[model samples]
Target: MAYCGNIRQEGCGKLERREKYRLFLYVLLIGSITALFICWMILIWEKIPGAIHIRAGIRQDLDLNVPVSGKLYKAPAETEDGAIPVTGMNAAVDAREAKTLSVDLAEPLTLYAEDIETYTMDLKLFGLIPFKTVNVQVINDKTLIPAGIPIGIYVKTEGILVIATGDFTGDDGQAKEPVGHLLKEGDYILKVNGREVEGKAAFMRQIEESNGEELVLTILREDQEFDLKVRPERNQDGEYKLGIWIRDNAQGVGTLTYLDENNSFGALGHGINDMDTATLMNLKNGSLYTTEIVSITKGENGTPGELTGVIDYKESNKMGTIEANTVEGIFGELNESAASHITTQAMPIGLKQEVDLGPAQILCSVGGAPQLYDVKITSVHLDHDNINRGIELQITDKTLLETTGGIVQGMSGSPIIQDGKLIGAVTHVLVQDPTRGFGIFIENMLIQ
Candidate 1:
């Protein structure tokens, strides 16, 4: 009986050891979970201000404590090696509750945050492992510009453009399409039957002279080149026809936005679209000539009005050479000073964030000259970062309303200034109201 008691006591000791082991594991697991949660919260704190811009001579505070609460330190934005100085500001940082970092701008400068690292102490390093960049754009605000100047733009597409095609009587005496889906609205016809075609007349002459044979077409679509075959059909007049409408050039009048420090100009807040097919007119080479306002078409409900203007034909009136026709507008280098015509009033750029809903001014010319008229910013929608309609505005100037009725067609690119800053430009007028219009951020134009 004594031997049995000894064995039972030994078994009890083994069971106690197993219970202690499991208890220790549970405590360790809880500690690990807590540490992981803390680390996660700090990681979120590092994602403050994806981008920031400050004008020269201004102090801006960046709050870095919106996410997890932790001790902060001076960390490199791009790498972990050396410190990149923030231009135009005090760079010394205090290692404590790093909630706010102040930046003072003296000149235009950009700094990345790679070498900056957050540490709990001098010995332990922390912050984002890969680090993130802080784009501290220190730009000057005041830019002098001439407003309300008229511009005549002419754009020639990269190649002969196919606008429309229809069916024609064929050799078999049946109505059939010679050019079908192989040609589209925006496609540029580069070559026909191994010969380069220059314009609509050239393309048609080449096709009709094909002797009713198959014509091989070299096509260019959105910078991509391919080849397709199109058959020529003889019409009832005994003449061969490809039955495709084409255009290679477009011209229109618009308002000039602003002249940059480098004498480059941006105009037409939106791109020029083919009025018939409604496709954006692609630019191969283009020019912007000076223009004079001719007449005004009053806008009413359901119909939008426009400013009718004429392009100056005199060679001395040539304003600039256009290089790009983008979604925002057409950009080009100025041939002369724009301030020579209108007021040389220079203003700073009002960022999209700085635009407020209130009374503003739009510089436009309807008949006589470029003038500043009162308008009110009605609403702002930031659903997209790149679209033109960032703000909705309504005309309030009595004289402007009496003269042009509202924003006119050629008023596009009229500069919108609020509180001495060039905020945006007129883009489109509301068809229903005729007195309200859309404005795009000036930063979009500057980017192009």
Candidate 2:
């Protein structure tokens, strides 16, 4: 009886050992599966675009895709009317491209999507899945803009802007730049001694009145406002100075691209960067006046050219108030008289996908008048640079080439019309090839 009982105990111990081994295998399989899933999520996150821009009622094919098992969901929220619209489309097995992501809009609306996978089968990954945040922007795909009409751009910074900083010898024996650290080129002098600084002269007056005491300066730099204290020093000329050259405003000539029914207009396919500092000009308040072309410097190989014009800044000739200075262009509300300048009825705007490599025409004020000029699209480039270069074009119009030797400086905002729609705007000309230039898609300009 003792021998039989011992055999039974040994058999039970073996059974227990087998069960432990089985459990180990199960846990190992699950852990291996979890690690693989994490790797896949990391790869996907790297592929997603930061944001997507598309037109209203248009279809935009994303350069991204989802896993075969992953799904897409858009979260709806309140949006401001007339605000720039953008949204992500739902996910589905693309009938043509299999499981890729695509965006299609039926109306002018914005959508947001936390592109995530909600898998519940067997593993119940649900909220464990990682996602990438996406903001989709949808904008009006069509609009009308005034072409060829020159606009006088008068823009002022928030305060007297420091054009440059220099060293100066003060009343003290030691040499110092009193504006050091507190001021730099591109910094705006907003206030002195708590008094609001309006322009260059106002800033100087405040400094002079400070009586060489430590003046509290409220300065604006890159959208950030800060307070600084500096003692103004007397120079050899017996004048208190900050030892910085400043400017109150900047003026230039730009072509008007469009005037919408809402009275909003856009021009100068790119922002106006300071010539001295090469920084995008920040706007405080500005005016757009009508401009009459006074002269033109025709373009040639290895050299850029420009249009010289006189701005009609009289109250009666003021066309609009400068609003936004953007990469795509400057936009603002136009006065009633500005409407008379543009007769090009508002037309549909063409998206990037619709732009083809073919013949097109441009409306530009090459020689004091807006006229239709022919151009041929040489190539359509997927943008790899900061500026939008939708298409490469070569001048084909004999009139434009003969008059300006191709696109000149003043033609930067000239609208490119194709198939009865606005496709793009002339942005830059190639110095090597006088007839060739770059253009930004009109859809890009519209969103701005």
Judging by TM-score against the true structure, name the best candidate: 2
Model 2: lowest-lDDT 10 consecutive positions? 116-125
Error of 2 at 78 (Å): 9.4
lDDT of 1 by residue, 1-448 (tens): 9999999999999999999999999999999999997787455423233334445545434433222221222443433333333433333344453433333222232333432233221111133233333344445545747466778888887778877878877767888787867788778888876777777777778777888888789998777999998778788877888777889899988989988767777888888887767877777888878788878899888988877888865668777788998889888888755445555577778766567899999998776777889999998653344367887999999999998888878889999999989988999999988899898888767766
Tell me the tens digit of each residue's lDDT in model 2 across 1-448: 9999999999999999999999999999999999998897565544343334555555545434444222222323432222222244433333563323333222222332222222111111232344445544555445686466777789987677778988787666557688777688888777777777778776778777767889888888888899988888887666787788888788988788877888888888888877887777777888888888888788888997778888767888888898998888888888877776677677777666467788999888755568888999887653425456767899999987877888888777888888988888888889987799998877678766
* lDDT of each candidate versus the true structure: 0.72, 0.71
TM-score of each: 0.72, 0.73
- Model 2 accuracy (lDDT, Cα): 0.71
After superposition, the stretches of candidate 2 with alpha carbons farther than 4 Å from their true spots are: 1-141, 171-174
Candidate 2: RMSD to truth: 12.3
Model 1 spans > 4 angstroms off: 1-57, 61-146, 193-196, 312-314, 337-339, 383-386
Cα miss at 175, model 1 (Å)? 1.1
